[model samples]
Target chain A: MSEFWSDYTVRVVVFGSALIGAVSGALGCYAYLRRQSLIGDVVAHSSLLGIVSAFWGAFLLTGSGNKSLWVIIPGAIVAGLAALLLTRAVTGLTRIKEDAGLGVMLAIFFGTGMMLLRWLQRAQPPIPGRSSLDGYLFGMSAAMTSQDLWMIGLIGAAAVITMLLFWSRLKILTFDPEYAAGLGLPVRRLELLLLCLMVIGIVVGLQIAGVVLMISLLVAPAAAARQWTHHLGKMVGLASTIGAICAAGGALLSAVFSHLPTGPVIVALVTLAFVASVLCSPSRGLLFRRRFVVD
Target chain B: MDIAIETQQLTVAYGAQPALWNVNVEIPSLGITGIIGPNGAGKSTLLKAILGNVPRLSGHVTLHRTDEAGSAAIGYVPQRSAVDWDFPTTVFDLVMMGTYGRLRWFQRPGKREREQTRQALQQVHMEEFADRQIGELSGGQQQRVFLARAFVQRASIYLMDEPFAGVDAKTENMLIEILHQLRDEGNTIVLVHHDLTTVKDYFDHVVLLNRKLVACGTTPQTFTAENIELAYGVAGKQLLSRIS
Candidate 1:
């Protein structure tokens, strides 16, 4: 146990996961308020396509099979942004609602990604490090290197700093976009900036929780924090704290158990927090409301 | 009379269907103007069009500003149903949003803005509820909160959508008093009002609309039975009789 605590890899995994959690949780407050909670999932899932595409493209161009994080991160960003724009276009140009558009994109992008991954596996000249692509799906905290941690920290800090700097405009944008427009705010530009931040948050989170479980990291902490606070700033702060704690705890537990995957464990912890918050929060909780009958 | 807002052959549409068509009207400055129309008569659409909330299919709207260096020339109170009141924010924070227009990007509200917000809340009799969550307010209180938000903008022109839709008598009276006070201070107040009963009592000028401008004149001249009938059909006469 002491050796586990002293191990450098375990320390990096824990710190990296916690940083990803805090960033995603804070940004998730806006997603939750905008009722676009599924957007994170959409971006995360679509990033898989970016990962596989970057791997294939890099190999084809350089005649090398080495899967570089540098190549994959940009690819994921491009794919995530593409998915976001396509979803917006589908919703804006057609009668299809935003939710339905997101669902369609999620399925198409994820399906194409899965097929590409399968083809890569079956290719005659097998990619040497093709298995690393799977890490972007379910995450491998145990395999995280110093380079991956630095990338995660850099992206996470950028997302959190941008959010803090534009806090007021973003708050109004999330609350009432029409009113924001009336005030002569650059509503479209502000919205695009927010989606760009979400893309950053989701991309960074993809390394720790992976695509399938990343949405939980984005949503659960914010959902739990919301039940406890009636102020947006406080809610966001609380969500970050909750996210960091859950991520660190999950990382430690997974490190100790050896058999438990860190991503699912972190997701489960956040879900538990959400349930506890919903049931026990002072003003809005089910138990409190049931007992006190706040009108 | 000085015209505060002028729309020239303004047309707005929702997809293929036109909401406001070839509407030309000038709102007089320093008066309470009531925009009265039947359901689906584009009353709210006219206000939205003027505020640039909705896309104008063609034509233009011009706000004649007496002062060039004000925070914002226009303040808007959207329909109560248009907002999610359950959003996590205090009444104070919501009102402070009015000051955001004047603030530069990334600039937080400071002492002056906070003071203005407090005064605005006091003006609307919502000072006590400033710290309360928006969702905790009654329907009338929520409307008052929105009004305070608009009030804090200190804009020369105020556009409100259905300020008296579902409020209690007390809140209605409070809102009417504030509107009168604002008008007396030489601010133009345009309200998309549904109640014909309060037109004579509430507005100095009335813009009667039915997809287009039916009448735009003083309440006595524009709120006539003939124009009301044109705007609201035969039921307009019945409503006028009941109100008169």
Candidate 2:
């Protein structure tokens, strides 16, 4: 226990995980508001293809796999946006519903990622010292360094700023898109901007929450927070706090154990919070409903 | 004396079916213009077409000056069922959203915006329910909250669709009073209305539509039994006679 406090790597892991959780929480509120909560999973899963493509592309072009974070981040964001546009186009052009569009996008993207993974395995190995991309597939909290912590913190701040800057427009657009447009709001522009931000957050979160469970961090905290409040600002704040606790607790537990996967543990903690919130929240919660007058 | 909305051979359709065709009409400012017709008579379609919510197949809609000063500001209050009411938002927050058009990016709502929201809530007699969740309110209260949101837009021209539909008697009366107030303040208010019983008593200007303009003028002039017959078919005459 004493050595755990002294270990610099443990500190970085804990801090990075917590910051990533907070960012996901903030972005999740908008996702839930848009009623596309599960789309976060779609965005996260689609990034795996981005990762492998960037790795292989960098190796083929420059004979290196240890590509800069800048290269990988932009590649992931472009792929994510392409997937979003493709899903939307399919839904609008066809009779398929939004949920079905999301499902198709998720499956097709994940399958493509698997194909890319197999191709990466077959290809000749590039320059050494570049780690396998598994850290993003399933987060490696123990391997987090000071640099990763700083990066996560910067991304978290940007996410928070995005939420605050467009809070009013987002609220109007989500609640009533037609009326918002009637009032001269650039509804389409605002919606596109928000979707862009969502992609950025999902791509960055891959480092700490991993591709598979990153979306759980985005949705579970916001869904849990929804059980407690109807006010948007309060819901966003509550979600961020809940997510931070889950991430921190998961990181601490993983620090104690030698080989436990931090991603699943963090997701499990978030799921537990959601269950508790569902049972204890004021209006919709099972227990609290007994106190309110039934209409 | 001033025209607020004018259409030139306006045609609207949804997929293969036509909702409104060659509907030419001129709406006056500074009064409540009631648009009443039978089901599928393109009442709501007319409103949507004018606001550009629905795509127009042909013709043009020219929106003139809202008031004597000629400001082009417009406001809209859609039907309650058009949106997901369970959205995570409070009455105050939703009303404050009306100020988003005026504020610059990255700036939060200041004290003036909050005060305007409060005043709008008071206008609709919803000040007491400002902090409540929108979903927790009754049907009438929810309508009033939406009205409050529209009021906060503070535009000189307002377009509303079925604001009194499914509301209680008190809510209906309250809406009439607010519309009259807005009209007296020199704002043009157009409503997609039903219930012919109160048309003459509540509204001054009227537009009788049946996929085409049947009549347009004061309620006594355009809402006659013949125009009602033309717009609503023979069965509508009996329905209007009972109420009239």
Say which candidate scores most in lDDT: 1
List ranges where model 2 is wrong by over 4 Å: A125-131, A291-295, B9-22, B66-71, B210-215, B233-238
Error at B116, model 2, angstroms = 2.8
Measured over all alpha carbons after superposition, the RMSD of each candidate to the real structure, in angstroms, is 2.0, 2.9
lDDT digits (tens) for residues A1-295 of candidate 2:
8887788888777887788778888788878778776777888888777877887788778776754455566667777777778998997777788889988888888779868877666656534434556767776677666765666677668867877878778778878888887777777898887887677667766766788888888889999999988878889899988888898788878878867788888989999999999998877998777643412
**Deviation from truth (RMSD, Å), model 1:** 2.0
Candidate 2, overall lDDT? Answer: 0.81
Q: Residue by residue across A104-194, what tens digits does model 1's lDDT show?
A: 9999988899899989988887778786677777766777777888877887888889898999999999998877877778888999999
What does candidate 1's lDDT look like per residue over B1-244, in tens digits? 9999999999998867899989999999979999989999899999888878788989999988643455344788989998888899999999999888888877999999999999999988889998998888888988888888888877888999999988989889989999999989889899999888888899999999998889998998888888999999988778877886
Specify the highest-TM-score model's number: 1
